[model samples]
Target: MNASTALLAAAEGGIIGDGRTGANLALGAGALGMAIGWLALARAGGGISTGNVRTGGMAAIAVGTVCTVLAVLHLATASGGPGTGNGLVGAIVAVPLGLGAVLLGRRALTRCRRADRPADRMTV
Candidate 1:
């Protein structure tokens, strides 16, 4: 299982030693780590197939895109002005995560297509 899924399962099982707060922290960290992991995989030219790595990368991209958009909306609605650090940090992190996911997905799709192609036959 991926980091996010494993963390979520652990949270559901109450496996975190620090209770709900710890579970929340674990989930958050797992999500971020998953995103980073996917990006690294993509950059490293891994997960070119329709495998777990590719699926994870796509999921990461979706989550990252959503997170980035939500962060932007939150920042826009914040009356405390643009100096709020949380929104800024979220924006900075999410965009790259989303872009990396998209890239990995594209790479996987391309590889899958290439693998499915039939080899040329001899005319003799």
Candidate 2:
């Protein structure tokens, strides 16, 4: 259910003879399953963290996060070996998307905050 539990389950039931965790852990489809599901609800909550968020940025973040999840799934299930998976492809997509989302979202938030401040008025 939780990440630690998913990880323990993965250790017991993951790729044979892995004896390790890396890309599989990073991608973490099993662990991410819960997180990805919760992300949508979190976005809708509209707290300080989620309110007035940029749409484009949010979209990128969601897609990037899922790409990472798929990447992990691919790595975990890879036949060749742990590091032999094509999940790097997912990482390639996710990293930039995630970074761009952060930058753009921050810029939008700054603009929103500035707009909320009162402006000076002049009198004759």
Candidate 3:
């Protein structure tokens, strides 16, 4: 299939079993993005020193955006409410998780930029 169609199918859980699959996938992605963002923020703040904080922040932002989009798509396409096995609750929860990730990533990015500037330079 084409790119758009394939993405829609993937977001819809691959045309397979129940609707929960998409929600679960979105939840997992959001959690992963949040974790990455947290680690990046820590690294930027000097709490960790093993990786590049800027790269981690960018990755977190991208993944978080994707997670939010997937969750929204699932919510839009879901057929039932909270108790009908449609994963409405999971999608609802994922929204904040994804936004949290984005916020953390942005914080880390700002820290990275602040650290990169040369505060001691003369403005001649």
Q: Pick the candidate with the highest TM-score.
A: 3
Count of steric clashes across candidates, in order: 0, 0, 0
Instruction: Kindly list the per-residue Cα lDDT of model 1 for residues 48-70, writing each as its tens digit.
Output: 43345445545655554544443
Off by over 4 Å in 2: 4-85, 121-124
What is the C-alpha lDDT profile of model 3 across 23-115, one tens digit per residue? 888899999999999999999999998999999999999989988988898898888789898888898999888998999999999999888
lDDT per residue (tens digit) for residues 1-124 in model 2: 7975554445333533342333444434323333333343344344336433345335435544543544444345444542555344443343444344444444544444555557764222
Distance from true location, Cα of 110 in model 1, Å: 2.0
User: Which pairs clash in the backbone of model 2?
Assistant: none
Q: Show where candidate 1 strays beyond 4 Å.
A: 1-54, 80-83, 121-124
lDDT of 3: 0.88
Query: Which window of 10 residues has the lowest lDDT sum in candidate 2?
Result: 29-38
Count: clashes, candidate 3: 0
| Each prediction's whole-model lDDT (CA) | 0.45, 0.43, 0.88
What lDDT does candidate 3 reach at residue 14? Answer: 67
Residue 120, candidate 2: alpha-carbon lDDT: 64
Index of the highest-lDDT prediction? 3
Error of 3 at 7 (Å): 2.6
Task: Tell me the deviation in Å of residue 101 in model 1.
Answer: 2.0
